[model samples]
Target: MKKESRQKESLGRILKYMKKYWLFLGLSIALAVISVILTLYIPILTGDAIDYIVDKGKVDFTYITPILKKMVVVILITAAAQWIMNVCNNKMTYNIVRDIRKDAIRKIEILPLKYLDAHSYGEIVSRVIADVDQFADGLLMGFTQLFTGVVTIIGTLGFMLSVNVKITAVVVFLTPLSFVVAGFIAKKTFSMFKLQSETRGEQTALIDEMIGNQKIVQAFSHEDEALESFDEINERLEKYSLRALFFSSITNPSTRFINALVYAGVGVFGAVSAIHGGISVGQLSCFLSYANQYTKPFNEISGVVTELQNALACAARVFELIDEEAQVPDAEDAVVLEEVKGDVDLEHVYFSYEPGQKLIEDFNLHVNPGERVAIVGPTGCGKTTLINLLMRFYDVNSGTIRVSGVPVKDMTRSSLRSSYGMVLQETWLKEGTIRENICMGKPDATDEEMMEAAKASHAHNFIKRLPKGYDTVIAEDGGNLSQGQKQLLCIARVMLCLPPMLILDEATSSIDTRTEMKIQEAFGRMMKGRTSFIVAHRLSTIEEADIILVMKDGHIIEQGNHEELLQKNGFYAALYNSQFAQS
Candidate 1:
């Protein structure tokens, strides 16, 4: 029952998308009606021409010629109407698909970061691209075949009833059987097709994961395991796909079998009626054509049912994505922060990715304006989680985080986040020229300003050596550039913006020591008057921080200037000594 409801809801939403193209839809329907009517009239003209032939010698060419000419004109008009109807259908189907894609992309943009963090990138891509393509195929088939099939069925039934009530009754009687068989098979196939779509998404995700990290798989000698996992997913996808197709394929043949019965019933009864002088031989010929036409739609409709099932399944998945809860909108009175003074405060904060995990609890911090604070902690100690909360990527479960003395929640997320310049360990660079990448945070930045930021981040030298200098177009995710170069570009991006506050989370992890030192100097200059939060594992890199925060298991174990913490010989001293000892 729930599955049926969901299918109806998905179909309803698709219709809503089509509502904007009602004029085109109406035109297509009108054309389909004209085409079917003209097509049905052709059989009558054919029967008339047949009656005109009497014993072959008494045939009247003048009368028969006009009927034949009328049939030709009807066929031509039918063909033209069908062609025009198809054009409208194609336009509407593609336009709806385009709108669906656009909505999916817009939803992705506003979706909470937590949602993205939980879902695999490849699965999302499949929903937006592969599933949508499948939906388009189904919609197009429905528009082209289903509409005409329905009109043909109704038109043929009316024509048959006018000629002979008994014959038309036989066709209607057998017609219900076709619907019964199709409905039974369709109910079974919907679940199979839904499973098939889900499994296909899993396979796509697995393949994407393996291909994107092939270097790691080879380095770890895990090719056999990767292939094994992929084979498992591939086999499941094949199983579901085959099962779905098998059930859907049954609908067509089963309906065809019932339709043949209807056709046979008409032939047997119409012949008897003619032998009894109840109808002329020409009328029997016309009735036979109407019977074939009436049953043909049943067969076509069954095929359409199969396609619509698959399309509905894909559409359900896409709508599920679009319907996901978006990030809470900024309050109506939310104020945009301007002229940020860089004072940050976190009071009694608590957060966890999952409930009952209690990752971070009662965390408190206060930074004076323009202070440089560094955070050092072991893995899984909520170091990165802290940055996530500060940037509003994930809201704290309890308590408040304030920037410049205003609660973060009270400020527009865009305005609050725009105040911070972040350079993280995992650098992300879109496929674009070096100049475009560096100027991403400030698209309209002057060339001199961009070059200065690049030189400050020690990326200018490398940029100048590139084949196209700053115009060098990198591959997606900066795949063509070395990790260090990508990191430098990310730093240059932050430098170009020069936000009032900074978050440097292992910002130089990818760079060599020499370049790291130069970047550190650049960072020192940039951090001079900005409130900066630095999260790093290397204790040596943050020794000059105005304050060093030692964290453990989501608690602030110690907090003081580097010298003060070193003198106290607490967790901070132990972490610092361990790093240098390892070196």
Candidate 2:
């Protein structure tokens, strides 16, 4: 019972995509109407042929040839009209589907980091590609076939009834029988298609996961386990696909049997009436032709419904993504910032990802214009959380965050983000040359400026040693470079932009001693005349910071300059001792 309700809901959702292309849809229906009405003329002409010869006992090549030629003309015109309508429908539907797919992607792309965190990577990927594809393609083909089929069926039946009520009765009786058989087929087929859709999403995700984490899988000796998981998803997809095929196979044969029964029944009834001389040979001939022609629309429809259903299922998944509310939205009339001086204020900011369990409580901090500060903490200490809130990844539940005395929310997000230069611990790079990745940080960077940024970041030497210098192609995720080289390139990339504020969140923590000296020299050159936040393990980097913050469990445990914090001697002292001991 619930299943049937869900099926209707799925269809309604699928129909929603067609609203935009409804004008072309109307043209398709109008064409179907013309075609159906014209089809009835052929059967009527069959009656006329018999009447002109057998009933009147007269034959003339002159009249018969013209009548037959006219039928051919009508057939050709109607066929041409239907073809044109179908072609327009196809073109319009494809555009609508493409636009719908693009919008769904746009929605997914702008979604907040938290939303991505909530869903599996595989599930999100499937929803974007396979599911969206199905929705658009299904909407086009299903509506086109179903709507045209109905028009032909209704028109054919009306003309059949107008000619002889008894013959119309004979044909209409098969309607319920055809529907019942088609209903059984539809139910079985829908279930298989649904299973197939789900299986395909899982398979796509599984393959992506295995390939993405091949290193870990191999290290853990999980190759056989991974293969087994993939095989399981593949097997399920094949199983459901075969079931849909089996049910669909039965539809044509069932419709054929019902059609045969109707024909035979009409023949037997018409023969009895003619034997009594109650019905003429012309009327019988026309009535028989009408019966055959009437079933034309039904045959076309029943065959396409199975296919249409599968497409509808795919569309259902797609619209679901489109309808989802984005995690963030800017005000309609928000304004962009102009010439930010990087004065930041975090005032009594209380926040949590989950309700009633606060990760940050009454957190307050203020940095004057062009002031450089270093923030340090243990893992899960809200060090990154402070940066995240500053970035507006999540909004504070209470209090306010301001940039240059302007509320972050009031300023347009794009303008607000453009004010900062951030370099993180994990320096993620694309598959590109040294200049390409550097250029990405500032697209308008001049050649001299680009090289200067590289020189300051200490990435110039290694780049020059490579085969093509700055033009060398780095492998995926910068695999061709050493860890230190990758970090240096990322720093150069960030330095290329030279925004008013800079953030280095453990950016040089993973490098060896030699690279560390080079990175420190680069950092010195990059830090001039800008407010920067340095999240680092190397205490020397923080020694020159105007203010130092020690964060733990979402609160600032201690705050001072490097010398003042050392004199206090608590968590900061222990960390300092450990660092020197390791050295």
Candidate 3:
């Protein structure tokens, strides 16, 4: 019962998408009716022409000629109608698929960060691209085959009954057998097809992960392990796909066999009736044609039933993604900060990615405008999590973080994020030219402004050496650029914005020591009159900060200037000494 309900819901949603194209749908249906009615009329004309031939030489050419001519015209009109109907179906199907993809992408943009973090990128792509394509194929088949098949069946049955009641009864009586066989197979195949779709998604995700990180897999000598994992997923996909195809394949042949029986029944009974002088030879001929036409649709409809099951399964997966809960909206009267002074304060803050994990508890901090504060923490010390909270990517579990004397939660996320310039360790660049990437934070930046920002980040020298300089197009994720060059471009991006507040989370980790010193000097000039939060692993880079924060296990264990912390010989002193000892 639950499965039936879900199928109905999936179909209902699909119909809603089609509702906007009602004009095209109506035209297609009207064309199907005209095509089927005229196609059925052709056999009657043929039967009439046959009646005019009593004996081959004695046939009346004058009477049969007009009927033959009429048959030709009817065939031409029927073919034209069918062609137009198909054009309508194609237009409607593609437009519906376009709308579905648009909705899926828009939903992804508004989805919460937590949801994206939990799902694989490959799985999401599969839902939006692969599943939508499957749905379009199924819908197109339903439009072309299903509608015409149904109309043909109904038209032929009516014409058959008009010709002779007894023969028509035989066709009707045996028709239910075809339906019974098809229904049983269809019911059994839906579950199998559904399983096949899920397995395909898993396989796509596994392949995406392996291919995207092929360098890492080979570097670690895990090629065999990667292949083994892929094989496991591939085997599961094969099992489910074969099972689905097997059941669906039976529907067409099984119905064809039953249809053959019905045709034979009509031929036997009509022959007996004709010999007894109950009906003319011409009438018998018409009945046989009607019987053939009637049973042909059963074969087509059986095939359509199988395809529809697969389509519904893929549609269900896409609908599930579209129905996911979006992120909570901002308050109705959210404030928009325009001129931030960079005064940030956090008091009694509590947060954890998961409940009961107890990562950050009662955290407190205060920094006035233009303070250069550096944070040094071991791995898994909530350094990045703090950045996420301040950016409002994830709200705190409890507490208030204020920027420029306004609670971060009270301000719109757009305005809050735009007030700060951030550069992270993991660099991301879209597929575009170097100038486009540098100007991402400020799209309307002038050429002089863009070049100045790049020079300050020490990326101008490298940019000029490229074949096209700033006009050179970078590959996806900046794959064409070296690691240090990519990092410089990212830094140049933040420099272009030059917001009132800055967050540098290991911003120079990939640069050489010489470039690092030059970039550090640039950073010193950038940080002179702005509030900066620097999260660093190297203790030497942050010795000149106004205040140094040493964190361990999500708590701020030590806080002071460099000399003050070293003289105290606390956790900060020990950490500072350990780094130099290793060097």
Q: Give TM-scores for every candidate, taking all chains together and pairing residue i with residue i.
A: 0.97, 0.86, 0.97
Looking at candidate 1, the ten consecutive residues that score lowest on lDDT are 574-583
- Candidates in order have lDDT scores of 0.92, 0.81, 0.92
Give the better candidate number (2 or 3) by lDDT: 3
> Which scores higher on TM-score, 1 or 2?
1
* lDDT of candidate 3 over 244-329, digit per residue (tens): 99998998899989989998998899999999997889988888888888989888888888989999999999999999898777
Inter-residue clash pairs, candidate 1:
none
- Model 3: colliding residue pairs: none
Task: For residues 417-446, write the lDDT of model 1, one tens digit per residue.
Answer: 899999999999998899999999899999
lDDT of 1 at 12: 100
After aligning candidate 3 to the native by TM-score, how far in Å is the CA of 70 from where it should be?
2.1
Query: Candidate 2: misplaced stretches above 4 Å?
Result: 1-17, 43-64, 183-192, 235-253, 271-289, 332-335, 427-437, 459-489, 509-513, 538-543
